[model samples]
Target: FAALARLAAELPPALAVLVGFVDRERRGERTLLFNAVALVRGGVVEQVFHKRLLPTYDVFDEDRYFESGARPLVFDAGGVRFGVTICEDAWNDVDGPLRAHYDVDPVADCVTAGAQVLLNLAASPFTLKKRGLRPAMFAGIARKHARPVVCVNQVGGNDDLIFDGTSAVFGPDGSLWARAPSFQEQVLVVDLAPAQRVAEVPASDEAAALDALVLGTRDYAYKCGFRLAVIGLSGGVDSALVACIAARALGPERVLGVAMPTRYSSEHSRRDAQALAEALGIAYRVIDIDPVFQRHLDALGPSLDALGAPGATDVTWENVQARIRGTTVMAISNRFGHLLLTTGNKSEIAVGYCTLYGDMAGGLAVISDLPKTFVYKVAAEVNRQAGRFLIPENTLTKPPSAELRPNQLDA
Candidate 1:
């Protein structure tokens, strides 16, 4: 508040600033947090708007953490009665996805309170083509209120979350005045007093997903204080795709690929992983796990003999190979202070096809939310967007496998 007050003091009489921040309030021995936006002018905060429509579904938990604001906020600044809203406050479109969630529309409330302009500060997470729908909703709000609507969304990745900054402005006639690009960070200057209007371009589904993953991976690593990443390469599509994302996210020089080959590992798999490493110009290492596998089998052989099992069974040996590989990569990650990236797809995780503390041993699961089918598509997209095979053609075409046992296939 002090910093903003000082900044407001320095601003000219004709200018004002709108900023989003978390507000803390005490209510009868309980501390409450509210997602809020403030309008400032002439060294004083004119009005503060708390978010009303707290979304609680599909990755959102606002209702659990925040106290909803009781009323809308409208304040006079620079000859305009600007209305301030924080995120979900302006998302109550009649035909929108969250329309049924709330009865009162914040946009309508602002206009009813005599607001000339509408402003929404948001941190909306990216999902498929979710970016395309927001502008349409804002346009509707602008048309209904007869007020120019401006939306500023957050950009970059936090943990596994991706916020696409497609900030935009619309005229009272429901026409787009200006827009910032999706999945990128840039300062957008909007002139709502525009002469010409442009239509909103629909974002491509595959392209947007690729960009979101890359941004999420980059921001997640940087925020966690990791400049380097390591991935256990199986030369399958899943690992190959993750390597591509890591290389792009942290630069090829910061990514390391380790291939742990065992007795059941295929020769083509080794070559394909190496090919990808060379193509991306990342550090690569090959470790033979057969000797280690032999040691484990020897140590467990006597214990298994008591269980009436002669040799390694489906319940044990295949997992032994997986655990060996996981340990190898984890050691590399820990030794070099690298973030270990797991390559298991959502389908495997959903059905518990993943090994505990084995293939699942990593600092982050890069593709745990990606399905096996979508894995192939996004991997191909990595190559397609590059206009060349950064990931080898054979890697995408080959049958998916963990190579933990002979004649095994993930299909």
Candidate 2:
């Protein structure tokens, strides 16, 4: 309580605020309860409101820790009366009579109690399509009540639940005002004017998605205690794109591109790999793997013969080459304590197109989730920013091939 008082005294005033959840039991009772909403000013907490509804079905266990509070919590800050709701409160229609049987009516109780703004604090988990629906739902709520609403979501990966913390605000007219990036923890400040209608603004959805991936990569690498990234430079579009993204996210010097060519590697591929490393300004190393390939073939000669000469085909031969490159990259990673980056794209990862322990070998797969179509787009974007063709134009235009045999393209 003393800490809360001191904090309230030092903090700036806001209309409505939420503190962390409190796990407690009611006085003289053994039942556990989770308190939901709290109003804070400066550093002091003014009031604590327990959640009125709890959900306990697939993936939710809120009822195990919460006793519902029946009434809405209304507080005033910065000349605005705000109504507060915890995660599951607004999710249920029975919490308030006005909200029953309607998507936006429960907020009526807050307005009746003199709340001019609605603030919802949530820790919603991520799904493939849930992100697309959240903004629209909030906008509908705001429009129905003719009041601005602010949503603050918890962010980070907790077990299987990944909170895509893109907190947002909507105007009285149900138009989005500001939105934080997804999958990241961010503090977003929104200026709200009473009865102001939000105007439709152009949004860069692709940019936002790309930024999320970039942030995820950066955080995963840095937070997991990795400073250096190693990429196999095959002079193919996929690897080139991964190299570009890694350089941008973790700085050029932190990224190392290795070009491992064999007897079957095309001259164009070698030249292109060198060009890409120079263009990205990252350190590049050329390690000829012909000797290693020969050693592997000799070691597996008896088995190859037993398997009816499987190594004689172009596909088998290409896979051998890929495994050799994978081995070389892993060796460097082990020696220097760097994170090996796999450059396979989504199109390949799908339908089991990628080799399991070959090109797919890496500590991190940068573009493994990105489709080949998107790979080209992002690579083009990188080049567009560079103001010149840093990735050889031929590399982008050429059909992708494993280059394990003469004149063979990846099917």
Candidate 3:
């Protein structure tokens, strides 16, 4: 807090900075830590307030860190009593899913303490449903309390969690004053006048999803020190979607598409992979696994003598082909120092339809969270967003297949 106060002292006198950080205070004889937001002005820290509510669900484990504050923080600022809350403080409502867990509604408590406006500093991560749901939730809170609400949410990706920074302002009558863009950073300055409402057009679900994926991929690679990406192009929707995301995330020049074709590989699949790579203007290469695959068969033939080593007809041989393709991609990843992207979808992974070390081998599973059905939807959105057939039409219309065996289909 002192360091932040010192930094705040350097700012212009007209501007006040609200900074969130860990604060240490003396309680009795023991020093305790708190998750606090400090209001700084006049070359010093004017006031500081702790986060009252701490969530301990999903990726959050606030209880394991600093202690929760005992009371709400309501202070006078610019002739208005501004009520302050942290991320989890505003999450608990009488009508919410966590109604039974807590005995407090921070927003209501703030209003009870004579607050005219509410400000929530949040770091909420992005999800498919939550993107649209947050505004409605905040608007409801504002209407219920009859106070204008401002929520400034963090934006950017940190590992697997992606924060879509859609900071917004809602009037006391539940009118939207302003809304920042998703997955991007912008300084939003909205006048408190009730007459100046910006008519914001919400992004479609597919459009929001595409932005999320692109931001996630870009942040994950850049944060992990990866400048290039590589993908195993199976000529299927899942791999195609991943490839398109990679192209957009880390420019087409930084992406490599590899197709490891074997005897069971279809001609159309090879063509589709090449065409998709070409359409994206990414690097394309084809590797035939016949030599290494046949050597593996020859070396393991004696061990499988009792288990019927009937050439490539055995069920276990299917896994071998997938593993060879996996190895082919990983080898390229190692040689080029690229981030390898896996192409398995949620449905296939849930039912254990994919091989263990085969299709699952990669630094990142780009489309693993998307189900087979949703994968197709996003793939279409990719083309629609481009206003052209970036992914070939046949790839979308054709039946899904792994092509690990001759005349094979995922069905």
Evaluate model 3: give its lDDT: 0.85
Is 1 or 3 the stronger prediction by lDDT?
A: 3
Which stretches of model 3 miss by more than 4 angstroms? Answer: 26-31, 94-101, 195-202, 306-314
- After aligning candidate 3 to the native by TM-score, how far in Å is the CA of 87 from where it should be? 1.1
Best by lDDT: 3
lDDT of 3 by residue, 1-411 (tens): 558967887988767678898988898998888889988877778888898887887888888888888877888867889889888788775365434257777878888899898999999998887865788888888888888999999988788788998888999888888877778888877887665445343367777777888999999999999999999987888889999999999999999999888887888989899999999999999888978888888988678897754765356778888888888888888898999998999999999988888989998887788889999999999999899989999899999988876688888
True-vs-predicted CA distance for residue 156, candidate 1, Å = 1.5
Please say which candidate is ahead in lDDT: 1 or 2.
Answer: 1
Clashing pairs in 3: none
Candidate 2 residue spans exceeding 4 A from truth: 1-17, 20-38, 42-74, 85-114, 122-133, 153-166, 176-189, 194-206, 307-317
Candidate 1 segments whose C-alpha is farther than 4 A from its true place: 6-14, 193-203, 310-313
**Candidate 3 lDDT for residue 193:** 62
Clashing pairs in 1: none
Error of 1 at 90 (Å): 1.5
TM-score of 2: 0.76
